[model samples]
Target: MLKALSLFTGIGGLDFGFEAAGFTTIAAVEANTTVAATIRLNRKWDVLETNLDPRRAVDICSSTIIKDAGPLDIVIAGPPCQPFSKAAYWREDGASGLDDPRSRTLNAFLQVIALTRPKAFLLENVPGFAARGHSGGLDRVLTGITRVNSTFGSRYRVHWAKLNSADYGVPQIRERVFLVGAEDGRDFIFPNPTHRNASGTDDDVRLPLYTTCWDAIGDIPSSSDDSLRMKGKWAGLLPSIPEGENYLWHTNRGGGMPLFGWRTRYWTFLLKLAKDRPSWTIQSQSGSASGPFHWSNRRLSATELFRLQTFPQNVKCDASRSEMQRMVGNAVPSLLAEVLACEIKKQFFGAKLDTSKSPTLAVPKSETAPRRTAVRPVPPAFHELVGTHADHPGTGLGPGAAAGARAKRDALRKFKAA
Candidate 1:
């Protein structure tokens, strides 16, 4: 069996996927106590409970004592990505650009690959890692890895692409960048997309339909956990908002007098699932107000979020609700990881590509049907207004509608000031 090493192993998502693809995990490294505990519970591999802090060098051979594991076939790591995350960039108070200490984790990952001399390595990170501003960092990583491969007398080829988890049958629209390198100098090709957008009109019917939010969590009964309830004045307002819609639906043009304009709020602000579409990206840390609300108009429970993240149903994660949320959100969706692992096995390990056993979900045919009966009714005036606006374009409200919305917003402001 091929042996693998996992770095920055958060609850073993990548490890689980590679194992499912027929690789044996020999050792894994993780820093978080809660996450490491979860990994220890689930996996029998050597779990190195130490931080992969980039400021200090990691002597994986001596420190983790993995030198005796024999030749490792692959190394997989997901370095901390806060340095290049869009959310992190948005939250920054000033224009410091792309410099972040967390980015050094990438260097630490390369150092491991250098020391272990694995046959191949896979690095996963947020889509922003490939952004124009971070291209210099990416170049440095590439150069560093090349130097390491040369020192070991192996010619390695590297390839990278941004992939959406939903394309691989995970019921969430999470886009991440994956970089794969091989010591054999063979360039890695990404797996063909197994699923397509629900609204796409491609002629190939053999390609599966994209998994939807309902496909993942439709069968799970609603949770009575207090953690699943939305709070504050907006709690009641959410159920009345339409599925796939956000707080913008309650703005003045939509028959409510909220001060915020359409598109002014974050996508997850009052976000609710549309049965037909994939769920929005599950956040790492969500408060009572942060939501991708259930179509039933409550916050999603940890179990439901796990389902969306493609973790096995029986996999129990023992942690506080908030910590569990962070683990799930930070994880690479197992289905996506599995798809990549299967391809890696075929390309590098001589394993036959097997589509017959790929994971799949049978989405309901009626997913796109109106969900009016699912939640409390909105006021008649607001309902009528929203019904008309829903037909516009781009969630039924386009540029022309934006102009009218702005006018209404200004008028409402005047009325409120009076």
Candidate 2:
């Protein structure tokens, strides 16, 4: 079996996928104590629960990790990506890129690659890692690899692409950037997408339909957990929103009453899942009004979340509801990881599987979708938010953005007065 080392191994989602694809993860490094404990409970791999930032700690060096894990065929890491994720853009000052201290893990990951000199290494991050303005994080990674090549006289070539999990038959529409490098200069080709939009025309009939939420969790037994029930002032409004829609459904342009302006709210606010469509990306942290709620007008159960991410059935999460959601929501869909691992094995390690065959991890399609839930009338309590609402102006002009601008101006005025 190909031996693997995992870093930032959040609940071992990526590691589990690699294991499914025939790699044996020898050790997993995670900084979160609860998350690391979850991995130890489920898998036999050694769990190192320590801060891995090389700039802060000399005790946890790449040499020490190498000495303990022995020879490794692959080093897989999904370093903390908050510094380069879209969520950062919503902050008052905007995305911090590499400036966020959390981003130090990027260097820590590259250090392991330089020292271990594994045959290949894989890194995963949000799409913003390589965005036009946020390319600093990616530049540092490529530069680190180049320096390693010069110092060690090795030919490590890198390839990277942003992939949506739904395109590979996972039931969620999560997009993430994946980077893979081979020490021997072997070329790595990303796997071709095996599924297409369910609404595709007959002209491109060969590809399978995108896997839908119904396919993943339609048959799941309803949970008794009351925490799964939608709460807050907007709870009653969810049944008014149709499947595959959000708060926008009640906007002036929508089929329902004009309760909101177009693009005024976060996309996930009051969002409800359509049985036939793939799920929206699961948020790592969501408030009471955050959604992609089940069509039953409630929150998705933990089992449903696992199915949408295609986590193997045997793995059990022993945490409370909120923590379970946090860990699961942050995971890379395991099926997507399996798809990439298969390609890496074939292209980098010369595995002899036929290129044309479908991946074993693809979620099976269901024969038919269930009946749509009945829509309820918008509650009278929310009637006050309706009428004459202005749509959000473009980016940097929304209410949140306007509020941030005012705060900045106020600070500047105070500074000038002083």
Which run of 10 residues does model 2 get worst, by summed lDDT?
Answer: 56-65
| Runs with alpha carbons beyond 4 Å of true place in candidate 1 | 54-57, 63-65, 93-98, 203-205, 252-259, 360-418
Give, for candidate 1, the lowest lDDT window spanning 10 residues: 89-98
**Residue lDDT tens for model 2, 330-408:** 7899999998898899888889877676666667788799778879999899989878788889988877777756766
Superposition error at 267 for model 1 (Å):
1.4
lDDT of 1 by residue, 69-127 (tens): 77789999887777677654443232112456667677788778777788988988888
Instruction: Look at candidate 2 and tell me the lDDT of residue 18.
Output: 94
Count of steric clashes across candidates, in order: 1, 0
Deviation in Å, model 2, residue 398 alpha carbon: 2.1
Root-mean-square deviation (CA) per prediction? 8.4, 2.7
Evaluate all candidate structures by whole-model CA lDDT and list the values in order: 0.75, 0.85
Name the regions of candidate 2 deviating beyond 4 angstroms.
Answer: 56-65, 93-95, 201-203, 354-358, 402-418
